[model samples]
Target: MTATTTADTPTAPQGHPRRWLILGVICLAQLTVVLDNTVLNVAIPSLTEELDATTSDIQWMINAYSLVQSGLLLTAGSAADRYGRKKMLAAGLALFGIGSLVAVLAGSTSQLIAARAGMGIGGALLLTTTLAVAMQIFTPDEHPKAIGIWSAVNALGFATGPLIGGFMIDHFWWGAIFLINLPVVALGLVAVVSLVPETKNPQGDRPDLLGALLSTIGMAALVFAIISGPEHGWASGRVLMTAAVAVAVLALFAYWESRAPYPMLDLHFFRNRKFTGAVTGAVLIAFGMSGALYLLTQHLQFVLGYGALEAGLRTAPLALVVVALNFSGLSAKWLARLGMPGSIALGMVLMSGGLVSIASLTEHGYGGTLLGLLLIGAGAAIANPAMAHAIMSAIPREKAGVGAGINGTLAEFGNGLGVAVLGAVLTSRFAALVPVAATSLPAALAAADSAEERERVTDAFSSGLETSQLMGAAAVLLGGLLAAALLRRAERAGDGRPGDGPAAGPDSPVGVSG
Candidate 1:
């Protein structure tokens, strides 16, 4: 559990040239998976039309993928450690491409949903393996920059996804979106098979199967219950029951992982204040960003009269700026000096303030809102690298892969929960404001009162969207305060790093105690 300080030249592992080439392959695989999560959202309209889907069916398309992803990332980490990382990465890439093909040809919503699940499994495997492999391949000194690009490409993929999906939906069919993944997958498979080396946990411990199952079921139930509660009343018996079940199952999961010999998820990391603080802060920031993005896309499309492609292009300011700043390594030095707590607290404050300005989002056009989103984006970019340094530095070098795997799993779950819960709040608020919306509608439309009066009801439904955006701002503000509270000045932390004054290491002499 202790890290060795060394200055030896890093071995090439064959050669440095081969490792860099392989890193490209790993990045491509990561990009494809991350982008697919957000990309399909923009193309949902096209999928609905082509597949003759009801609204609920289209919801399942997204929820199913995310549910599977959120549920299994932790288990997938265990699987990667038990099985070989290189084999998993290669197999995952191939399987994902096959799943894409299945989706491309599917004629019904159910089939497409299953196909997306297949894609998620493949995605979970690839994501867990890629980060782990990258750490194993690169020298410690060069690891941050390499991981930064890897992280940036992941951010870039999500950031650029809507634009790509919009272009395909506008010019071609929904299938074209899945089709684009083929070339990348083909190249990635070839590169990975040729270049990546195999690694597994030499200990060969048994994976906690019961813990994995409970976690999967609990996450699925919780996410589904939250997302569907607005459509079905939150107070409804079915919704209440599902919530109860999710809580029970998750409790069982926590108990099992605690006692299991080879836990799918290691819970002891939270004993370290730096680890706990960083992760909690990450979840809050993600909540703010995810909710805001969901509301803003709709605002641009429905209210501001922008086409999907144009909407994506307009928001390029935030995403592109993130890309630029992340590449500059601007935040790393500051966070290394200020430590985890200070940097995260500052970022959350800026992000929260930014959300306030963005809440004043106008139907007429965007001017200041863009700047607000930019601030939020910059905050997120700074926080990403700082957290990585703090989290990894807490773990010894040998366990770097495990730490990153755990971190990534939590990050993804937070993303799904953020999107689901914030989206539910917005929907519930819009529905609550419907009476006022109906009053504002044309008298003739308002008077035509039946479930069958689709046109009038649909028109009245439109105004509630603006209310949703404002609510999104409130959610972001709340998340900011919560994230800020999670930060503590890490400069005062007693970790036994290079500059720490009187700090115990995370694993010894008196191990981590939050």
Candidate 2:
């Protein structure tokens, strides 16, 4: 539904190139947010070295962001539309910058966690608003190219996250990783303030605080339940209670949203088959890919004894293949060829196939399992762009922010859940055997400096990598088979236009070249 307040069409400012400037702003914002997700992971080891933080707490370093971001995304998106996208985006950047400063100066683990939560707020704001901003800036024809650019830049940022983090950790302390966000945010703030215009939802939907609260709580409950399940025994009382709370929260959210005058999340979007299917497919693909990725890192570092750079290089195939395929996809009949569901399903299958192939490598070493990782990487890279494009195309440009929020939030959730599920499996299986394995091999056990020894323990960790890989493979295969069977046909654009051209639309994101 279009909002009541009409947004003024963005006009090009003389000597100021509005399009290029907006592109720069969105690219920078996306890079900062997406990179934050993975870059911090590489520093976990280093951070623990510097600070006596526990692994469980360190996991929160990642989870806290996901939790806060995912919980707030729907509300943030709705707020951007209700208030103003540009204003909201700027507020987010400012908050992120503040949080980055906190992290840079953080003395304790709890302080760092709070800073991350602050950064999460800004990130959610930026991520939710960027799509809406892009929708406002570009025309229908130019939109595809812009979206491709945004996608490509996001690809580059996420692709380089590990390499950047690894390089920083090698030279600087862990804090430098976050300290680095400053210059980028500075550039974005300047550019956006000058170039981007304010956009408000003309639909004039009041910010439904109750609806927002319900959705936020519901999502938090569900995510917490999933994440906590593996830590606590799945059948344990805590797990059961969490699940029950999650169910209740979700039911409450749905009921409240359905009745609210202006809901934070538009539940009716699911009535559109394309929207529902695309979202469902999006979540599944992320789950499959994330689960596999979590496992792959273990195999690379633990089993193969790869250094940070080497481990990143091994997974380079995933990024490389995606660039090649995406470049060629611009020329090929990607949109006209497979349509939405077809493209999504095809991608899911390839990803799952590659993941499942890991089962083969379980018995073998570097030679046997390396191929599986490569395949999974390639499959994931190829499928992700298409899935993103499908989600963008399915929604009306007016509500792109909310739609994008849901899509973005789901992707993050899927990634987190994927790691948790597969990781829990690997951890559980490995832990059970660790006691047995430790007793059997005295060499594998830690020395007198027990905690320090464990922190510095790479050799034993590598031994457990095999178990993680097996679990990743199983998860991928299960997801693959499910996608292949469930996704029956391809989905075309809303207009069903023949885009032997790129599958992007009039309001897609920007890329390297705007």
Candidate 3:
């Protein structure tokens, strides 16, 4: 349970005095990266017309960044831990800026996809190192509040992306969306160089080259298969082959990490119930939220006949509530009263209830979905900080980078899987109910020859959406129950509070809570 002092470990018992300033810089960096996740969603239509992009090209453009970023996260984190977090963060910002420039200049779909992939590399480094830096800067007592703010910024980014993108696309050009990242990147770079201290594991072993390669390849293949499944049938040869490769390589990765002296990721982390529960809860929450958002955006645009800007604006309530709760410290208060397990369980149940309410929507308008959005926002605000604390506290300070990377990777995987799986479900249900032969709602609407047929198509789409919501709700509810059970068991076994695990020590940057 003890830790050795290293050059990177903060000597001050209260941790870094400039921790708040450093957190602002970190949150800025994180916002830029997270904004890219949804900003492009609003630009899809513009790009289709401007670049003459095909459906396949458009999908790749969207998938490239996430696929590459998710694949490289573990490797990037391990590198940061071995080398330096601040250095890695600087490199990420520089690369991301360059990628933005490339994207702005891109006139072809292929060029844009390549630019996005490059940004993905930068995003992987940024996302992993940002959290690692935060862990190094803050004491355990301050961890929840810091993480709450960080989580709030994350929600803010997702919410603001569409609104920003929509405005830019309307007022200027499609490239303006990418151009917006430049100022953030420039400021982040300056702040990081001046304020953030270097941190790395002094006793860390040589880089696990083979382990990194296997992990990157496995994760990339898995994401590719998931992305491909909805566009091409799941049973298609390409998806099947890629999925098989992913499974085989990931299995090898597990075996290698278990035996390697300096594994890129330590397989033993999964043995800790707190870590496992937090990770599981993260994936499930991501799955439900991402899937719901994906469907709701479409429903707003196609079914309810809202513009991209309008749809984006309508989704603001969720983000607003999350931000309000986090900044007001209400979420932390709930965490204190409920404990980690109870808070996480309550949050999941709220989210599940929200999904159920959305599923029960009878009126085809935004008013019907308002209550559900508020519930989801509250749930996310309460659950995310607890989950982050549980996962990070279980990890040694030296390995904080990779631990954050693992968390990011699984969450990204859950996001991609959610969209694909839910999209598939909606498509299937629509097909069964629609009078037309089209598999998608847009296609069905276009193919409908009569007014009655169009009505039928809309009805079918609504029914499909309801079904998907219910499915997501059920999965999240079950996951919450299981995660709560595991976390409670860990506590009963004398793990102490989330921040008081084996990793807490005199030299530990994170503090131990009583």
Candidate 4:
């Protein structure tokens, strides 16, 4: 039971050729998960009309999926390595398909939430194991290219979610969005069973059930607390209590991981500065972009007076840039020339610049917004692949799933927290800037009470968005500097004595800082 590739397993150069097919299936499944992340937002109106969903009920629809997926990602990834990547992939696809069908048939808000959580579990397994599977099938030389394609598909899926969801909502029932996933799931299941090779960590110890429990609970609580903070009042006892519990549980999780024979996440991997930097950069990137985009969408709809479809269409320029850069083979070349740390810093700088430009935009400055979005998208395109490549390159092949899971967990947490924190910033700013004479902006604006009040609300909201953008820009710039510094220090420290310093081994990719 050595942790070596099985004789029957297919590799990139092996006579049994199905590596690309495996990648395709993995991406297809991944796309389904990614789409679910944002697609439901567009369907909320239809869902409320059909199911009589209250505001809180609709919020849970989104939160349930995010919470469960983030919570279970680490456990799912580790389990995939211990159990078998192919087996987990197949099981995950099945679960996802079943969950989608259940969602389609859900008669109540609670039922939909449950189904969404089920889908989250499936998504966690699928996403966590996919990178491991890709790493297993492709040779070292081909791994980066494989990752580039994967990243492109991932970004595209998320980008197009609203568009696809809107189209379905307009033409069909809200259930159609969930129904669309079935075909992809079916194809993925077939590919996983027939084309994909089984890979597992034969040396992996027994599953860390207790560690998994703590990790899941901690992550779920932390995400919930973050999402609810703005709504419940940041200083409210409920928020404080939940936040404290999250901290306590996570602290316990870290301690358990240090001692567990088979930890759900390997704590030592953080010793690699490149891996650590990559993870931290991913979080910050998600933090800045997710929060900024949330506010931008509101700006487009409320400030610009665009319809849902129109706003989504206007965002297409950003999505196009992301897709183009990721797939055009440019990112790999950038990585080769700039190195991981430098590339990440470059991307962050560009995004920060874009955010600043966006902050300067006026109500009539459509051109400025598009220009800013394009720059932001370009930066994201460059950063995402490089970070994924860095994480894969830094880790031992055997721990690929665990590494992937950690990457995903951090990304999810960052996205949710970003939205919460940034939303709070926007609300606070709006409240402060509003004229003291005006009562409620939403209510006043909706009623068309007075042109003066309308103008004041619009101006104040615009100011709030600008402030949020500035905050996001600063965060991204800070993240870039930190990543650059960490990488440089790690490289200077060298591999050193085993476990004594960061592990930037000889096998680590050239141009990738320690």
Candidate 5:
């Protein structure tokens, strides 16, 4: 079985008439997956009280979904390409709905974690297929605009997840959060079945079973190791062993893909600097965004002493700015003027600045953090669509599913690493400054016997957070520069102008290559 290039399949000259409607359905599916990623954060307290969940159980409940989703993304994407995007989408919806129902009915923390893992499977399929389906339905000329909307919806889900979850937990019950997914899943199924067209790689080869197994095990181990680092000591035997296994397995997976007859992921895609650069930007941005959100949520709840609902409400500005910029066409306009590399770099620069603002002004309260949130949101709006476009354009349409999967896998990897590494930094710094032996801020505060001790713990936590934010900002800033350099190098090699559309033939900046 030989590999087939995307050029083997001809693209439609025009997009589907119902493409916009289909996009809505696709966004709905995307929202469900993205929302689940963050929504559970607000529900942790409820679970602790309702289910008597231990610290380890709560951590697993949060990590299981991400671990499974990240691990299976490459396999799911490849499967969608081999089978059919519409079929995968429908199956994903059914599975996700079932998982949500199971979560709602779960009687114990173990059951909830298992349900989350199931949902992760569905999420992997939904995420890859939704983007792949969107690529199939839209013409290259309209990909940027379509991606802008798609990216905005992604931001919306992340931004609004806590708010929705907080509300559900406050008014109804913890189960309400999972229960809400049912209607969205049902509607998505209806729309997928009715409006979405079936698409797959016509020349796809036999299943890459070995490739899939290696990739899955490797990614799962990688995510597991990351999640464990902050909880277990980073250099502890368990974390070290897991990290080693992840590295060894992923390396083997990479080597196998290069030799496989029908590789699950094309190793050659990295040779395209634009694709690589876009992917780098995605990882760095996700790292910053995820780490910031994780810390900020704690900062709001613990340091500022806000209730869950109030904290969720306060974070609304981040999502609002992202949605506004993307929908107002300002993001598109910026993409046009700045080009792909320029846009990504500029967006990341703004994000770094936002993180810096938050780091420097922590003592000033919510008033100071608000501007940082808005800036971060604006940065994401400007960069995310361009990054998506660069990535999708570089892949042949035939492999769009796996392409989307690859994008997703790296972003998730970045997210996991951000939380783990930044969290570890915070923990280490806090420990160094605090006089208490408690492992966490909440624990330390509880252990504090006097007002002076409580004040000391709070100040230590705040200082640790500031240090973590500055570190994140520096990492993102450096990543932006490196991505810009890579994109510029690709242009100088005569790939084409950065501003050219994906339809600009083989000479285009992000043109698909055999």
Candidate 6:
């Protein structure tokens, strides 16, 4: 296979003046999907009140979305390549809009959960295709910059979701948040039809249907075990059984994909050290960041006695820093100077250091916590784009959708893992310290009917947060070390290239040697 050069890769022709318009449509879809990840948090109180939902039911409202999205990502990507990317993107947008509408009218807990799952399905389709379409329109030389912009927009969506949801909830009904996606989706649909060109792989082999089914079931089960493990004892029969099924099924998925005539996910991609290292680094950063955020939000609200909105507002600085670093064109300079491995290692170092700094945060000293948030934000800004570049550059252009799907799945998996692992640790440590308390912090807080018990629970929770942050720090540092080692080997083997380097000329292969 020959490497594709900038001239040979699809760079939208001059006649296609609508490429940027198509980008706008993709960004809108991307933002909607990213925002939904956290946008519903602001509506949790309303959901409980209006839907008469139990605590567990309310939690499922959030978890159900992630479960479906992560489970179907790879399937969606392969379907796009086998079918048509533009067609899938349009279908996804329509599905997302319909889900939002259904969510607005949902009257029961189960209905709301189902609506969220629908949205997740749409999100999986939309996100997987966006990058694939972008790859097809942009030349290899321009792909990194386009991906950088997409990453920046994605980060901005995550950052703003809470703020937007909070503001809507303050003045309007909770359904107003769901209503917000409608106009955006409508506009996206129009722009997509008018501007985006339909593209699919004519020579693409049949999708691995059995592989997709096994992957979906296995991934869903694994996420289910992880999400529920902290609430239900890890040793519980259900948890253990679910985990066992996940492991067995995922092993089967690997075996099937390896033998499939056309695998949904090519197992051989992992054979490339650069691709594996990039994936490892991405998952680690996501795990640490997600876990830290989960703890910090609780600390700000429960320990510091801040309102939900106040906590969201306080985290605004971190988002602002992330946007500045990712959008300022400085990342290109950093990537050029540090290279992919160095950039990821440096980011992880900053993030780990920041988590360590804030591990012992107190009620009165938010300065240290803020500094830590900023450092983590900066690290993410540098790491995310470089990771995307590395993974995409290492894969064949025809597999862009598969690459995007794998990236999305890893991110969601990392998030679920982080929350489960760190949350379990926090619960265990808090339970150990407070012998009479409930096994979990939330349970303890709920069971605390008296002010005295509440105070004790609060203190225990704070201690748990400290311990969890420390653990998160250590885990991320280990990831950084692993990334450095793997990347160094790639460099020695002459496969590692600076993130901003020009694409191999038209005659070269898509990726470097294994």
The alpha-carbon deviation from the true structure for residue 440 of candidate 2, after best TM-score superposition, in angstroms, is 18
Model 6, 1-514: lDDT tens digits are: 2122343556432222455566777988899888887677656656655676544565567667766787788788888876778888999999999999999998789988899988988988998999878776665656656777778777788767777877787778888889999999998898877667766665556766787679777877876776567667779988999999999999999998898888888888787788888888878877787777767766776678666577667766767877787667777678878988898889889889889877865455888888888887787777788888887777766666777888888777676667666766776667766635564455667788888888887788788899888888887888777876787788788764322232222212222110
lDDT of 2 by residue, 222-281 (tens): 656665665567798887887788789879888988877777677776665555555676
* Cα error of candidate 6 at position 44, Å: 4.2
Task: Output the worst ten-in-a-row residue range by lDDT, candidate 3.
Answer: 505-514
User: Please, what are the lDDT tens digits per residue for candidate 5 over residues 76-130?
Assistant: 8888877778889999999999999999999999899999989988998998999
Q: Which stretches of candidate 3 lie over 4 Å from their true place?
A: 1-12, 48-59, 230-232, 362-364, 437-443, 496-514
TM-score of 4: 0.87
What clash count does candidate 2 reach? Answer: 17
Q: Is candidate 2 or candidate 4 better by TM-score?
A: 4
Give the whole-model CA lDDT for all candidates, comma-separated: 0.65, 0.63, 0.80, 0.74, 0.80, 0.75
Ranking 1 against 3 by lDDT, winner:
3
Ranking by lDDT: 3, 5, 6, 4, 1, 2
Error of model 3, residue 509, in angstroms: 11
**Candidates 2 and 6: which is better by TM-score?**
6
User: Residue 252, candidate 5: how far off, in angstroms?
Assistant: 1.3
Write model 4 residue lDDT over 1-514, tens digit each, in one string.
2233333333333212568877888888788888888778666556666887644465568767766887788788878877788888888889989999999998889999999989988988988888778876776666667788888887777668777876787778888899999998988887778777777765655667788778778876776676566556779998899999999999999999999887877778788786677777878887787777767766776788765566667777777888788678888788778877788889889989888888886455788888888888888777788778776666665666777887788777676666666766776667677764332344436655678977987888788899888888888888777876776666576632232111122111111110
Better of 3 and 6 by TM-score: 3
**For residues 38-62, could you state the per-residue lDDT of candidate 3 as single tens digits?**
8887776677668876444655676
Clashes of each: 1, 17, 1, 0, 0, 5
Report the C-alpha lDDT of model 1 over 1-514, residue by residue, as the tens digit. 3232222324322223456776777888899887787677666556655776644565567667766765676667667665667777887899889999998888788999999888878887777888867765565555556666676776677778888877887888887788888888998888887777665554444556687679778987898788779878889988899999999999999988888877776677666655666666666566656656756665566445577677767666766766776678765555556555666666666666666666654533487678776887777666666665555555544343455566666666666676677667656665564543322223323466675564534443444544444555555455445444444533345532331211111111111010
The best-first sequence of candidates by TM-score reads 5, 3, 6, 4, 1, 2
How does candidate 6 score on lDDT? Answer: 0.75
Task: Judge candidate 1 at residue 90 and give its lDDT.
Answer: 86
Q: Residue 249 CA error for candidate 6 (Å)?
A: 0.9
C-alpha lDDT of residue 292 in model 4: 79
> Which whole-number lDDT from 0 to 100 does residue 507 have in model 1?
15
Root-mean-square deviation (CA) per prediction: 6.1, 5.9, 3.9, 5.2, 4.5, 4.7
